[model samples]
Target chain A: MGEFPTVTDVARVAGVSRQTVSNVMNTPGIVKADTRARVEAAISALGYRPHASARRLRTRRSSTIGIRLDPMIDGISGSVLDRFLHALTEQADARGLRVLLFTATSPEDEISQFRRLNDGADVDGFVLTSTTADDPRTEWLLEQGIAFVTFGRPWRSDDFTAPRHPWVDVDGYSGLHAATRAQQDAGATRIAYIGWPSPSGTGDDRRRGWHDAMLERGDVSAEDLACLEVVTADGVDQGAAAMQQLARTAGGIDAVLCASDALALGAMIANPARVPVTGYDNTPIAAAIGLSSVDQPVDEVAAAALELLAGEFEGKSGAPSDPAPPPFRMVTPRLITRQFAAIPRDSVPVNALVSEVSR
Target chain B: MGEFPTVTDVARVAGVSRQTVSNVMNTPGIVKADTRARVEAAISALGYRPHASARRLRTRRSSTIGIRLDPMIDGISGSVLDRFLHALTEQADARGLRVLLFTATSPEDEISQFRRLNDGADVDGFVLTSTTADDPRTEWLLEQGIAFVTFGRPWRSDDFTAPRHPWVDVDGYSGLHAATRAQQDAGATRIAYIGWPSPSGTGDDRRRGWHDAMLERGDVSAEDLACLEVVTADGVDQGAAAMQQLARTAGGIDAVLCASDALALGAMIANPARVPVTGYDNTPIAAAIGLSSVDQPVDEVAAAALELLAGEFEGKSGAPSDPAPPPFRMVTPRLITRQFAAIPRDSVPVNALVSEVSR
Candidate 1:
């Protein structure tokens, strides 16, 4: 084998610490520009390259993360899972880890894959996504004592205070709270929410955000809340139908917020009354059509997820009483304001609806 | 360790060969239904599970295929690469091979990754995508005598008939030919094509298909061909610009075809000529907006690519002097006719341009 420059050599040439050199190569875009420039120059001058397998053998870690792809297609229009995979792979590359991709027809099938990949010692750990309430995979992995960090939060049907597995979830609640405030500030009095069917942790979180924001505003009536909140399956057709049903109500909704961009886009299309609509997951369609939506920090989610997963191997969060909350990383999502759909002047006001309509 | 049922147990229970049982597990969708049913019943009857690591120890194989994920995002509006990855992962799962994804910034960086992965005995083979002429990766893998199958055909710069590495490619030529025929059948004569600037194997194949089809139709003169065949960069704006330029030409093109759906979508938006446009890679936007497009058979491509890669390990085709050419497997793409955009008959044809302008 030809002689290759090492971390020490690169560090020496660049006049930087060994860790800095590692960081520069592993996470390319995040390094300081000047430090990156110096490290890159040193790398080019020395023609340095890190030997991954040698490092793997020395660490006794395969340096691979296992992920399962769903065999059946879901209704995610913008390929968010794909983007997440893209980001995860990039982050894994930066960290000198290989991503092992497999497919599962169901959650049980996924558990089978996890066992196989683990038994083979092919992967150091696994990264879980799209976690749901009473997740069987999480329960199984925990029982087997496998090292993993999920991209989504565990439902944890038991005590919420108990320390558990590491996880990173996008804060959909905060995004919706901000959206509700934005709607309030936009002269929308009779605001309505179209969320996915209940019992979903994500859906409930988003609904609570709206509820909390509305309570803080102190203007919404309890009767108004009961009239406006609706649940439906995720689809453009479903969103449109929900909105039409809301429109036929006595007071008539002045504005709408959806859990997804698909719903928002549909609402806008169905709106003859020009009700302002906002959606979550600022998808490509939302950006293309100028619909207001929320953008989840997928990049940050991947980074934090990797960091938490690595923490397991590093023994940073081994004991339940460690007090750091098991790196229960919660990433903040931001509101993306685009074509703000404004409510028309002639729209019936919620307060005056009974009188005006009765007359 | 508890003794678990293996492929032999399943085979014995199913009254079939072990290979048939393996096939039923891997490539589940492709196996004959009756065989699959029998193997499935056997699997359940015997409670048999293929122990991946045990099988690996026996075969001296890792049961993994390495793939490089590109960090830079492309102009594919709907994340076609992500969909391709999804399909590939599913297909690989069916074939009992896991896909290991890594990212490299350049060819040299990629070579470094390949070497590290190889030295570690991390994977059984490699799958290459987007092969270019004189591809450095291909050359290196070939020199090292690594078992690999590329999803793209190598640009044949040398002797066209020489024994080369195995590959699977979507037949862009046939897809374009079908598109041209579809347009011609829709009562269009002056068909103009907008393709990516070439020497790209894919671009060349698609352009040649259109060129040959136009010739077979025998309707286009050399001068007409010159005006019709336009080359530009890959983008919607570029397509709009190219179509606009084609519009200013003397004959006034009646039908348009694009190398990508992004370009076709752009042409539809910038349709001053009211030409019906057909696109390749029927993305989500195309399906939603009812744009006619060519759907590349991603599933078939993944299946064939896996089969060819496995063939190398199985010694299906061996030696340079062997009479049979490498399968060079080509999957066919089908033309998807959606809400077909038809030109308005009352709109001024190219022949009426002078009179309309004068008036």
Candidate 2:
């Protein structure tokens, strides 16, 4: 019930005028350095709070970026998304920016929300993830001339009108190839692929890698591997059902490669303790379960996406004649081998000493 | 690429005056119902976008609520947080409000960020989670006369100075009681409790429930139980080590109770075929693993919190007083059981089949 200390309190504490205290907060560089320091110290002491809503009203800009998430994938737990968002959040904070969140059930709904934001002038920019190759929303964003960066590349290159659209993509094909080759190295003649293949650019790339790797092996025929084509947005259920079906029907498959850690976790749980499951996206769940998987550099992807969007926001589109295409920034995933079969037996400690790296 | 549509286009299409079109978009009640319908039809046809920001600037209200999260917990995957946030976001959208996110690394940093927002004139109100006992920031908010609703009750009653200060919390202690009692029903007397004890009121509450349930059980004594307190913020490794220690030292513990699904997953993976583990929160991982746990009603909590906050913001104090002394709202939780235990022959089929009501 105590009255809050005002600007006058800080002014009296610092032995400066109220105008000087205001300058320290609003235009610190304009004030003498020593005086500004004293003013700041006094302000800290009094716990003075400035009215931000009124200031934003005066400035006519909210230094906040609105992020819209597709709801279908919202069911996919945060274990996969935490690292990427955390990196983005930390970096955004460092740049004196904040994030606004919008959620939509479908592509059309997301576009409507985006359009509303554009009309509202509520945010300065946007960051999008899990984009499809032929996504209609991307075209709409381009039409509105909104600055955006996506985590995954769109499947259709022809839909892009903004020659300098920025995106951060994982080398999905390369990661799958490495996983398949690793299985082959471990004396496996045929490997089963459990994944959801769609017009999704990443999924297609992974399928291509599996196909190419099998072809390179020569001994394994296309018919030998099981490809689960039905991909549900509710990936956990889909993965569980897919694994259960595979377990009931498949024969002699030594290793399984999954497109996501969620699917891999489901596959592992449903494996009846017989088969080895490998997954992409080294999420915390995979680490906890001791499933060997490819670690997509989520931190790197988030950083690159921000840098690209920041560049566009800063008006450095890279060219006037023909803007240089934003590089298809592909982060190579590292193979993170844990308690599964990758490590040598000698390295397996007899004691149950838990590793400190928790996700 | 095309010029944006204007009021003239809408008027021309609708066969109405330009003013009528404006009224249809902004103030529909002024226009005749038929005329309003015509104008709306025309606007949709032309893909007309209204200038939302200009109107907000004119009105001096953005209709946005600021949300601040603890950075350590913020890193706890968007997927886990999404359920609660999605609920809040949807509730806000239903009332035509937006959420602006402000991330802060610590409590001290959050105070400064809050000050910045207040001075910057950005947000109308705040929705804060992680309000610990003796929260200094909550006290500061009251001192500044800002509108805020904490997700939980602050520890110190004196901190609840603002007449309009409101809070919404999950019934953690009661849910924990249910979970413990359920384990006891399943013939688990020597139950091991695993989790951290800290600012997370939920963790502490669950511990209290476990303590009370054990004390109430005449068959179980204090010496028969085990408590694995994970001091590290890094949960998975801490959980694994803690579980390993409990598994080694706790001679007669029949079951394990976890503060989070993350810990349960770790324990399950580490022991595989040994102990029966139950988790709180019933996160997606818990579902995938079929761990019997308590399910927090995040949606209900979010809706209740928003309703209470909105009531306070509308100049209504003593609004949430429920004719009870505690002045607290509690959301009911459900017990989710899966394949964590060996069901009796008669119980196996019913439990194995997903409940018809659930379906």
Give one digit per residue, the lDDT tens place, for model 2 in B133-238.
7677887776664667877766554323432357777767777777788778889877778867575666777778877888898566665653433343435545
Q: How many residue pairs clash in each candidate at the backbone level?
A: 4, 20
Model 1: residues >4 Å from true position, as ranges? A1-59, A72-75, A157-163, A218-220, A272-274, A316-324, A340-359, B1-58, B72-78, B157-160, B243-251, B272-274, B316-324, B340-359
Residue B143 shift from truth in candidate 2, angstroms: 0.9
lDDT per residue as tens, model 1, A195-277 = 88888888899988888887788777877787788788876656767887788772687688998876775666567687778
Lowest-scoring 10 consecutive residues by lDDT in candidate 1 chain A?
A350-359
True contacts kept of 2: 0.22
Question: Where is model 2 more than 4 Å wrong at Cα?
Answer: A1-61, A72-79, A157-164, A222-237, A240-251, A316-323, A341-359, B1-51, B72-80, B157-164, B197-200, B222-234, B244-251, B269-275, B316-327, B341-359
lDDT of candidate 1 over B143-204, digit per residue (tens): 66567988888878532365378888888999999999888887888889999887788888
- Please list all clashing residue pairs in model 1, or write none if there are none: A26-A94, A276-A341, B26-B94, B27-B94
CA displacement after TM-score superposition, residue A203 of candidate 1 (Å): 2.0
**Model 1 chain B — which ten-residue stretch has the worst lDDT?**
B350-359
